[model samples]
Target: MSRIAVFGAGSWGTAFSIVLADAGNEVTIWGRREAVCADINDHHENRDYLPDVKLPDTVSATHDPVVAVDGADAVIFAVPSQSFRENLVDWAPVLPEVPLVSLMKGVELGSLKRMSEVIAEVTGAGEERIAVVSGPNLSKEIANREPAASVVACADEDVAKRLQAMCHATAFRPYTSVDVLGCELGGAYKNVVALAVGMAVGLGFGDNTTASVITRGLAETARLATRLGADPLTLMGLAGLGDLVATCSSPLSRNRTFGEKLGQGQTTEEIYASTRQVAEGAKSCASLLALAEKNDVDAPIAEHVDAVVAGRSTARDMMQAFIDRDTKAERD
Candidate 1:
């Protein structure tokens, strides 16, 4: 039995810990707030992020990073993408040289670094030992023991297999892969597409409009993935299309909710002001736009969302722009 350290106490992190513990591994979670630790230890619930979900008692929470990772067989880095680097810096001394897996899905601002790269930079860990988990995973559904499959990708195939073992339950299935880059990038890029779909939905577009977005969104995602030396099929798998569909359709997805608020005529600042939950896509949108431009890739939906969020263009204006694009062959 492995002792798994989940380095973030957010909804997904907490739910993942429960999955691991249910799989018979010992799991501990670390959160920045002392109350979060108390909530899990005393009440078995992350009332702030995951209310009404009763976590198993086997999962413990702690404020000390050392206590969190002490003698753990492996760790999952589930921290917010923005503060991932900082947390790793703090975790460097406390965490053992165990294999690490990331649950983050965003390109780092300015550097456009992937989460695995950030993991290595912050922890001084080897690249091959790092891994990523991505797919159609919604915290609430997974916590409810709904059937779901996630891709566990790492440079080391054996590490991926190990993670798959730890992540597996009757309801939670993990598929192993040796393409961490594709899996991680697919997870990161899909959020931008989800935001676009949400905006289209909020603008009163019917099923046909949103359906077209999903198909073309896959095409655009594949183009970028291939340019980055990722296998095209990986984008078509659990981490890419699977994840995109789930994120776009689910009301629980923070990225979609963030975009819906924008479509409802709220400014980015105002939307954020109204919610205490962290919607990752807000930060990921601009960074993804920057990456698309830097790589000379065309990502119109992503670019427009970035503009809306940055206050350079209103959502209504962007919707008009989308409509003005020249008609072409569906796949052209």
Candidate 2:
């Protein structure tokens, strides 16, 4: 059995640990909080994140990063995208020369790097040694052992296939891909689109509005991703369209929920005060927009989302801006 170390005790990390263990791998989770580590190890539950779901007996937890990664076959990082570099810098010394899997789905601010890129920069790992997992995954659903499919991507086909085997649980099916760029871009951009969808819901808009935003959001995501050297079909697959639909439609999505609050007139500061979980879109919109601009891609939806998040535009103003844009060919 493979020994997998997961560095994050949050909802997704804990949920993914279950997947690894269910697939007959030994999983060790490194949580920052001692209480969370104790609960996972002693009770087989992450009380703070997935309190209702029971974890596999093969799964355990530790507060120490060294303990988690010691003798591990692979290491998975499911931490917040904004703070990923900081966390990796501290943990890199203890990390083994094993495959690194990133479960994060947001672009890094300032550097405008994808999570895989950040991993390479921080750990000095080559493209073949890094992988990413993303799809229409919601932490609670996965933790409940619900059926789900995700893409496991790496530059090396062999590494991707190996990872696909490691997490191939009965309820969790994973497909392998060599298009790491496409997978990463699709995963990152969808969060910003989900924010837009959530704002529509919070504004009391019906399904029609949500549909328009979703369709257009997909187009925006495809434009940016393709411009940045990603395969367009990847955006059409599970990582892009599937992820967008789930995150935008599900009330469980943190980014969508955060945007809904913003549309309901709650300030960003107020929303941040109310939750411990990170809404990736709320934090990554600016960076994503910046990335699009750097590539000279037109991304009005992301631009509006960034403006609203920065307090420079109200949700209503964002809607109006979209409406006021000059008519053009749909493909343009």
Candidate 3:
């Protein structure tokens, strides 16, 4: 069995560890807190994040990064998109020569680099060695062994296939793709779109509005992806359309829930105080807006979401902005 290292004890990280173990891999997950590690080892449950799901026995946890990375055939980085750099820097010395898989979905603020790019820059790993796992992967559902499909993207076909084999379980089907940019962009921007859809939902807007937002948001994402040398069709794949549908529709999505709270007039501080999970969309929206600007792409939905999250605009104002836009061809 392949030995896998998952760095992060959050819901997604823990759930992925379970997937690997269920595929017959020996997995060791690394977390910051000693108590959380104890919980995974002693109880086989991450009560704080994934309350009801039980982990497989082959999945364990450690507070030590060295212990987690040792002898690992594949290293999965499931930490927050913002903190990936810091965590990888600390773990770089102990990182073995193995495929690095990113479970993060955010554009790095300031740099606007995707998670895979950040990993490459920090770890000095080549494109062939880095892969990204993304799709409608809601941690709780996956933890419950619900059927789900995701994309495993890398520049190297062989590496992607190897990773596909390692995480392929009956309940978790992974598709391999060489369109890493498409997969990465689709996963990252969908969170921003979900926020917009959530706001529409919170404001009591009907499916027509939500449907419009999702479609237009996807178009904007495709525009950006195409500009960045990605396959336009990837936006229609599991990493794109599939992921968007799941994140926007699910009550289990933290980003959507966070946006719903905002639409319902709760402050960011209030939401942050109540939850331990990181909503990557809230943090990634601004970065995405900046990237759109740099690339001269129009991303009105992402812009509005970023503005609302920054407290510079209100949901009502955002809706009006969409309504007031100059009439143009739908293709434009």
> Residue-wise lDDT of candidate 3 within 197-300, one digit each (tens)?
88888888989998998999899999999999999888999999999999998889998899888888887788889888999999999999999999999989
lDDT of 3 at 100: 95
- Model 2 Cα lDDT, one tens digit per residue, 1-332: 99999999999999999999999999999998999999987888888888779998999999999999989999999999999999999999999999999999999999999999999999999999999999999999999899999999999999999999999999999998888999988888888988888888888888998899999999999999898889999998899999999999999999999989988988899999998899999889999999999999999999999998889998888877888999999998
TM-score of 2: 0.99
Model 1 has how many clashing residue pairs?
A: 0
lDDT of each: 0.86, 0.93, 0.93
Candidate 3 — what's its lDDT? 0.93
Displacement of the residue 194 alpha carbon in candidate 2, Å: 0.8
Higher-TM-score candidate of 1 and 2 = 2
Runs of candidate 3 with Cα error greater than 4 angstroms are none
Where does the lowest 10-residue lDDT sum fall in candidate 3? 262-271
What are the TM-scores, per candidate, against the unseen true structure? 0.97, 0.99, 0.99
Model 3 pairs whose backbones collide: none
lDDT of 2 at 275: 85
Worst 10 residues of 1 by lDDT: 209-218
Model 3 reaches what TM-score against the true structure? 0.99
10-122: candidate 1 lDDT, tens digit per residue: 98898899889888898899999999999999999999988898988679999998899888999898888988887788788887878998999998998889999888887
